[model samples]
Target: MIESRVLTQDVFEDLARHARRVEEAPWLEFVHGKLEVKARPDGNRGQIIAWLTRLCLQAYPDRWLHAYQGLRTETDGEGNARPDAVLAPIDTFVGQGEWASPDDVLMVVEVTSYDEDTDRRDRVEKPRAYAETGIPVYLLIDRDSCEVKVHSEPDGVRYEQVVTVPYGKTVTLPDPVGIELDTEPLKNWTR
Candidate 1:
């Protein structure tokens, strides 16, 4: 059996450079000096991200929305996290390479996949990380539950306010990006 290796930032960065040379390399993240691999988004997952990206960009033309953008959400060397979509001001991302600090992010979005690990991360782990990193909003589109949850007002490891809506309903985003997202398209999406 092959064992996974934990690498520091410098080592991880070097390996990443080489890994990208391969065809269809899996997404890699550094967590607490350990290398973590993430699966590529499947068809349904990609479609949902694309739709949300388009909708968000159309609603706020001046802002920027990027999929699979890695973020440095913590400072204690735990590692970086790549949200499904990151929303921020256009100017905030200039020249920012593979990973940007959470301070530059306005909102983070995650679309849960069918896998149990993916579900757990999106529902439990990610919210705490995003909130602790001081991200203003964490939007979760849970395919299994067929609902949308808006998490805001991060106080500690959790968001102080949470608003949930079914896939067919609309959810109003809070200040800084006050807009209603029509989740009807999400209803048609399957895992």
Candidate 2:
């Protein structure tokens, strides 16, 4: 039998520091004081991220769009999460380090990968976590379902407004990020 131990913030930071030095370290996140390892995204996932990043950058030229950036969703402990992409104001991210506070974030985009855990994290847990910190937008692209979900209007640990659209359609983001994302290319992606 194996026993599990919860890691403190300091311990988690130390592990993260070491992990960064390794050339081939898997993506690591500290979720509720527990270390969660994620595999490297495959080619299809990479293409989706790239497309979204490009679109976001083009849509909001004055903002910064970061891919796989670690976010600090909690102030008390290690509640670090790495979303597929983060959109923030240009001035807010200056001199920021590896982890950014969700308070400064304008929006978070997560593209679901090929796994059950990824589905739950992107569809459920991530929205709750991001909303808890009052992030204005949470955009989820669910490849498995061929759908895109937009979650906003945070109240408590959930978003008050939830909109879902199937692939080949367009989803309009709310004000501050008022752009319609076309999902035609995303619909062509296959497992």
Candidate 3:
């Protein structure tokens, strides 16, 4: 039996191999040199996501709405990361063709956990990737701070405008989906 000492090349090769071979591993992802297999979020987060999805779908019945949690997002040729919540067009998500590319993503909502580092990554890194791929809207719900930021006006490689929706405020979205999000339900979110 041979136990080989690991090398960077070996590790990179292993990661590359994993990316190459697709599996039914519940949407595993690699972010910042970490192989993260995400289980579903906890009770509070799940409740919020579910409520939001339900309301949004009800508001716009004709539109293609989805409530996908932690779908693999390929950032580069070999890197695959997953966002917390994604709302994409129904056509692409149905697997009618290839997996939904970043451009197909209509809106992305990230419910920040207690981890500031991960929140920072969601705030800083993901906007760049989404903007680069031309995803129109990126909405972030910060549970810790009790704030929401609606990112828009994609300029070059980043979102130029960030509309801040403070806690206990009814937030209004842009045209087409001109529905105002009531923050009343979220008041008891921390409990």
Candidate 4:
């Protein structure tokens, strides 16, 4: 339980860099002033990301889905998050440091993992953090529930609209990201 009051952003960034250098250190995130350990993806999870990458590329060759891109999710720079994937125009991240600004991001994606804290971290915290940062969309692929949640229309405090659909159904990711996902393939990636 490392408290935010005790850890400056610079120190946390240094610690995060050190963890990256170590072999197999757990992925880390700083949200709501607390340090959190992100669960590593399993093989099935990896496949889902790969599939998404293919779909995204076929839809828009000018955009890219950057995996594990760390972001500064708060205006004050206190909250940092490493989204599973980020959708942006090609070259949007050029020369940006480890923590990139979310300004040009079209959408952020989080695929739920089989971990205890996932419900709170992915479902609750991430949506609020990304919305507060004024991100256009927050997409949640919930394997446990076999559903996909698309969060959009950020009004600063939270996303005003959230549409949820069961796996195998089609979901459109709204403008700024105008991609329609036929979620039938997602069923094959779940547990």
Candidate 5:
């Protein structure tokens, strides 16, 4: 067997310290006790995120749709989540302060391309976190499995409702944006 690289607690403390230094720092998700750094979505992942953002823009000309590694949410100390696509109310996101928080997010979207376990993380763990923080909608796009999961209705620690859609179907945002994405384009997103 190969050797392992273990990250000590000090490293996470250092990262947290660094995280506070930058303006609009990259977002990171904490799983287990370790940290997973966030990176911009790759070309294939970016394609779908971009398309969906465009669809959101067309759907709600007033608000804003942001994607990739910059959105922040509170789940823990410095709790930041860089969802693939996040919808924010224009009123809260004018130009300063906190553009988006857990409560301000109308929807948080994740498009999975690689990482099998990461897919599951978004499915169960992140949904719970989002619900705990009272985000209205959690949209998950499983490109590999050709599935879409919509988690709404924050109940206790987890969202009470889970609606799943397959490739042929479309997942709709109930209100706010009131739009639909033809999830078929995401059916064959293989990395």
Candidate 6:
């Protein structure tokens, strides 16, 4: 097996920027100081993000839901995460360069893809990274598991509360993102 190389934050950022300029290039994320390529969203995944965007818009008209917003999850500048979606004040990311700070972000949303890395990237690494960044909420819509996991109450290292409910159920996002999600529509997008 060939050994994979780790990239520094600067090198990763440069590559990420270059990739953004090319059409149909897979999204790049730096996690744990390693390069991770995320496949472009399929139709089902796009629909899920659209559904969540509508809900967020209805809940907080003053807030904006940014799809695929890159965030600096580590204070030490170790890695960057591009959440499926992020809800924050309308102008929170304005004028902020690539990889904005997560301070103003109210919540980060991740819709798991059918890829093999979903478990490690979305389910495991993301929660820890977002929590460490002090993001108020981390919403994981697990298509493989057919469940929604709401993680909140970040105390620096990890989210203290993790509430999991299967699809077709009602799940309430906690403080900082007080929105009720009717996950029934999510079932339509699940694999």
| C-alpha lDDT of all candidate models, in order | 0.78, 0.78, 0.60, 0.91, 0.65, 0.87
Displacement of residue 123 (Cα, Å) in model 6 is 0.8
Top candidate, metric lDDT = 4
Better of 1 and 6 by TM-score: 6
Q: Candidate 6, residues 1-191: lDDT per residue as tens digits? A: 11126566777889889999999888998876667877678899899999888888988899988998889986565778988899999999998887998889999999888888889989888898888889999999999999999999999889999999999999999988998898998888876
Each candidate's clash count: 1, 0, 0, 0, 0, 0
lDDT (Cα, tens digit) per residue for candidate 2, span 1-191:
11116576666667777898999897777665456776677788788888887887898888877778888874352477888888887777556777777777888988888875776567777788788778888998888888989998989679999999999898898866788988889966746
Candidate order by decreasing TM-score:
4, 6, 2, 1, 5, 3
Instruction: Estimate, for each residue in 1-191, the C-alpha lDDT of model 3 and write its tens digit.
Output: 11123323236436545654765444445443345443446688778888777877777765444554333343452334456666654555665222245556667777676654555466776676666555667778887778888887666478887888877898876543456888778767754
Query: Model 3, clash count?
Result: 0
Better of 3 and 6 by lDDT: 6
Q: In model 4, which residue pairs have backbone atoms overlapping below 3 Å?
A: none
Clash total of candidate 4: 0
**Model 4 poorest 10 in a row by lDDT:** 71-80
Cα distance off (Å), candidate 6, residue 25:
1.4
Pairs that collide, model 6: none
Q: How close to the true structure is residue 81 of candidate 2, measured as C-alpha lDDT?
A: 84
In order of appearance, the predictions have TM-scores of 0.86, 0.89, 0.72, 0.97, 0.75, 0.94
Which pairs of residues collide in candidate 1? 32-78
List candidate 4 segments past 4 Å from native: none
Model 6 CA deviation exceeding 4 Å by range: 1-6
Angstrom error of the Cα, residue 181, model 2: value is: 1.2
How close to the true structure is residue 97 of candidate 6, measured as C-alpha lDDT? Answer: 80
Candidate 1 CA-lDDT value: 0.78
Q: Indicate the TM-score of model 5.
A: 0.75
